[model samples]
Target: MPFQNTMGDYQTRQTLETFGFLPALTQEEIFDQIAYVIAQGWTPSIEHIHPSQAMNHYWPMWKLPFFGSVDLQQVVNELEACHRAYPDHHVRFTGYDNYTQSQGSAFVVFEGRR
Candidate 1:
């Protein structure tokens, strides 16, 4: 109900906050969103989204290894495009590091007020 209260106030924007979960996003749906980033010819990884800030934080998202098959910068560019598309929306590419190559469910983030 809390999110409903805040989210209801800005219905469409709230929808943007979601990880493309409307219309009942199945695995394919999640993959579809991920594919949006991947289609740019980069391996999309969960390098940035955070759990607390994500609607799909607790979703059944998982990560797998890419094993010498990845293009980080391309993913970065793709995500950058996504960011450009959603300027006002709160999104973060939250948690990727040297050890992990970001292979998890795509989750949007609500960033701090700039």
Candidate 2:
């Protein structure tokens, strides 16, 4: 017996790995999310990688996670700095939960030009 294909030639659209399905987030929304993460006592971190490699490779951290950081402006400043330094790379923000030893929240803040 031979196997039969159920669907034929269906093409899928490739999108960004994070927050791709929804509308893009504004600066204010991003700030709010960051503040929430901090209030929850989660450490925040930024990571970036070339858009082309976003799906296959792990992004490198922009700097050490802002552990015990209470200043929201400082985290925003770092995020801006990372965007300035790597304008052509996809930038992502993450909140690390110490209790779960895993990421509690994450989303792409910037999408690189294709």
Candidate 3:
């Protein structure tokens, strides 16, 4: 993937990228990773799309996403709810810091398995 600035435009970055995923990461692992992202002062947001109609552009999962919240548990709960709600669509959680126009991390907990 190319670098994306906060403006939803592509740009290069001097910083190293941080990201990871697994089909088998445990719930505790997810919480730990999210907690680390929250500790970085980044706000988490979710995005999902249908596997059949995948778009090149990113689509937000929430209309009004929580910004700069320090509540990791609540964020995790919201992720769980999203996973439950869209069990058949690809879903991802991404932490963004709007000020820097940079995303701290992104995780895909569900792959829309049938």
Q: Give per-residue CA lDDT, model 2, range 1-114, as digits (tens).
A: 112233341124345544555567779999999999999999999999887888865789998999999999999999989999999988899999999998899888887776
| TM-score against truth, every candidate | 0.29, 0.84, 0.71
Worst 10 residues of 1 by lDDT: 58-67
lDDT of 1 by residue, 1-114 (tens): 123334545464434333433443444544455555444443344333333444554332224323333455544454465455545444443223324544334355333233
Clashes of each: 6, 0, 0
Off by over 4 Å in 3: 1-23
Query: Best TM-score goes to which candidate?
Result: 2
Judge candidate 2 at residue 62 and give its lDDT: 97
Better of 2 and 3 by lDDT: 2
Estimate the TM-score for candidate 2.
0.84
Candidate 2 total steric clashes: 0
Clashing pairs in 2: none
CA deviation > 4 Å runs, candidate 2: 1-13
- C-alpha lDDT of candidate 3 relative to the true structure: 0.67
